[model samples]
Target chain A: MKVPNILKKTVPVAVGLVVLGYLTLYFVINQTPQWIPENLTRLARQADLLENPEAKRCFECHKEIYAAWKKSRHAIAWVSETYIEDSENRSKEKCLPCHIPRQVKNGEKPQPRLDHRDDGIYCVPCHVIDGKMHGPYDLFSPPHPTQKNLQYRESKFCGSCHEKTFEEWKIAGVEDTCQSCHMARTESRLVQKPVLSWLHSKKQVGDHSFPHGEITQEDLAVTGEISGKEFIVTLLNQKIPHRVPTADNGDPRLYLYVRFLDDSGQEVDRFKEILAPQQDTALLYGKEARFQYPLTAPVRKVEISLQYKPAWSKDKSEWRQLSYPVTGDSG
Target chain B: MRTSLINSLLFTLMLFLIPLQLQAKDMVVKAPPESLGKYYPPESKEPKWIQQMHKMSGNLGGVFVNLREKDWDNLDKNADQFVESYKEASEMVPEWEEYFDLKAAKEFAAAAKTHDGEKIGKAVGAVGKTCGKCHADNSISVWTRFHWPSFHKIKITDPIEEKELDFGKYMGLLSGTFKGVTVNFKEGQYDRSQKALRAFKSRFMELKSTCSKCHTTDDVKLFYVGENVAQAFDGLQKELTAEKPNPGNFWKNVGILGKQGCKNCHLTHRSYAMIQERWEEK
Candidate 1:
């Protein structure tokens, strides 16, 4: 065969470009899309709630989702002991709206729902509007009266109440929406209330738990070392694209506890630093919160731990812990 | 003649005393007179009592309309026809025959022949009062006793144990299994709770077959064992058996299961079924 030099060279180059382009497309598409603060449509007060729909009514069909949401903090937000004490047994009306929020539209801060305060950011408030149930998809829920509102996919919809966290997320320029992490999507029938449920096709349904942090070892990078008289630990928000201990008006605190032990696992001395958004000590996106502690005489080892109080909780719970033994040596 | 009069007095006194004793003592729900059975199911293909009542009603209406038109011949015929039906219906129930105003009915018929509107009106009023009095005394009793379908014959094949069970026994078994879950869960017996929940889930799902048999209406069937109740059953079972089960959550889920899975159906059918069962037992 006659060798066509130009054709051979061009064909190889074209094939190379095609392969490279394919790889680029694959990687780029999988990367999380940056959070764009949507100019969400006003969940305007089109009408009052439909006869104060009970949470259990929503549960009749959304049983699985209800089960998940039932254990979530949102379910007991209004009834939580901390919330009650903090609000002075509901004497402070200003602290109420977000706890028992009304229709969560991107408008002014929502007013508290008058009755059914125990429901606390339930299905009807988030999904129902103006006598019609609104959601992310248009489904054939006959006689049920539903409208498709795509804004549920937007970050601004959640921003209506999570005002500060949404702002932090937007500033982080992460390629993910609040729904991406918190309201993780799974393919399932939207309404599982049967007979009617049989007719539905699988769709992306968000976790109704509005889940808390999915903190993993990789999400918060913890590294520790010890010097002659100082033990310095650096905790970085490596993977989570939002600030740690983030909330609107929440006081969830991340306490870094540094303890010195006399080689017997008995704490001899302890020091604490509160990392919270209000205190500007929260670990931010691609940022680190460092805690450097002094090792006194008779201290043979150091124990480091992070305990956290949830958004509406007053009780401290163990977040995570790690230990380092610098017995007569720096580790 | 003296003996006959004494017997009549004794029978009248007995009727009043019998009712009073029944009220003061056991206080059982009053069943309609046994003669009323001739109007209901198993004795008749349809409600013969209701049919006969409707027929008499129609005839009365015809008589009134004929009277209004001043059609003497038709009014006279209408009155005779009404009297005939009234007499026949009164005789249909042996005990009810005595309560019929047979003389008043005949008087109305006679008044229609006279073509005196005032006399006919008086006779009609007299007959109408008899009908109203009987209805006022007995209508609700008739409806309560015979109108609703009795749970007497509904035999459910309980799916869990795979055995034949009468409606009441089946209901007891189902509820007992559910109650086991509650009792055991409260006592921190998770294994027993899970077992009872498993049995309950099967029985509950199988109930749909029986429900669909009678509840042809989709909504009614849905109310008892539809997708919501089915899902609630399944979700409850899953939660009770989950690896990191939240005991409080399982309790909450059980409450939901009771509402949708048990209480809603009981609200619609239980009290009525209970009354029917009691009636049958007696």
Candidate 2:
């Protein structure tokens, strides 16, 4: 079984090619930074380091993890609409301590300094191993090295700030938790039943990312009309407390003044109720605040106005109003 | 031809397998019903917020009986049990049910259970606190002119008594860091709203009594309902002011008196009979 001349020549060429590839790869590998840099992993592992200069350095290495954290609710917790509504000092220490845990926890200079006020939820505190905490919280350092426990992965971690919702749940006897409601098993269409009909459409195929983002007024068409005079408007309450164009307490409630202005801008008579009840016992899910308004006259334009104020404002005209037109025709 | 067919089959297989793998990973991380407690502190020691909230709820219980119950001491003795029960409901119960907090309501019940005057006062205080917190988070504020007209035009009209709008009596009670923008009214015309909101910033701090605590801040922006009605009322009032210019008539039309809009009744009105008759169901 002697090898053919061509085959022998090809084998040597292949070996030579393989050797050259190995040498190239070796040089490339040596030049690259270490995959698990000691200090980087160390900072990520320790909650204290995560709060210190080490955390910023760790981000230099673990860019992906840091990005995920920056986008999270924890990083920007203080700056959140709900938190800002709670107090005047949107950048105050009381709020920042829980939101930007690293600032207070690490005792970084500038005393109560937050590296990223915009980053809602800090990451390393939540994800680091050995970052053990007693309850939903533990103010003092744990006796052992800190670790990210599976417990933090649970809804109770979120419940620390969401006390009202947690209590309502426990009292009501609902078994479902936040994680069950928010996280997904598949990147399927988020609709409870898939709209298979969309597949037949001329549009490109669905990517099925369970589309979650702020849906502007433009995206929401007057999908269904009660009558030609009445239209259903799906407006997003991007803020957590579920009010459009939110403002401070007890001053002015949000009023969706839906006026069917004729060709001339005159208010038409119509049946109007408060869009949704303040004690919104009606457990409607999703971000959209669905409102139905009936117009008195033939409406050329349906205007949706969201005015925010408390019941006892010092002045009426001072109330803030944010009015936007729904894209599609209501009539 | 065979290779092409196999390649086609493999493409379909890859798409199917990839989605399946992604789906499996997603299931592991998917969110649970928000009602389920994600993580509980092993021992159920309520936070400062919860404790303060309980004390307030007890105050509400007392409010129903004695309109002028002071401090949270009455709450601990009378309403503590009711607040404790509701606290359990709010902290422990997991769904929205009929009278969900009713069964666990201890403040009001504690008063009934004990039949003590001071105990009843405490129970009411706790309940009031809960209402205050809920209203604080959820309601909004609106200002309406309730002052008597400087000039009277009509004769033989049903006249209402003059009430004080003096900021002095309510100096400590109503002074709060109001997170609202102040609008300049120039000879009855609305001017531009400024960038920085001029809060009655120190209002909440001055509010020592339950009435001041609950009614001082406006949650008008937070109300889930009555936007249309409120606007209509506002527009109608403006129209009436231009046309009628009579304070008594406008007050009659709005069905309210005093500076505060709805809080005028809800906070100031004590008798249950009057509250039922005057106020519409929220």
DockQ of each: 0.01, 0.02
lDDT of 2 at B153: 14
Give one digit per residue, the lDDT tens place, for model 1 in B161-261.
Answer: 54668777888898899898888878878768877876777566656545543443446656666676666666766766677667776767777777886
CAPRI-style grade of the A/B interface in model 2: incorrect
Poorest lDDT segment (10 consecutive residues) of candidate 1 chain B:
B13-22
Each prediction's number of clashing residue pairs:
4, 141
Runs in model 2 lying further than 4 Å from the true structure? A1-54, A77-87, A90-97, A101-120, A127-148, A164-283, A286-295, A298-331, B1-282
lDDT of 1 by residue, A1-331 (tens): 9879999889989999988976564443224212211222123222333556779977777787888799888898788876664443443445667888877786457887777878877887788777778888754444355677988888888888777788888888878998888889899876677644654557777888878865788888888887556788899998776678886555566777778888667877666666666444578988877776655457767788888877565467887898877666432
Cα displacement (Å) at residue B238, model 2? 19
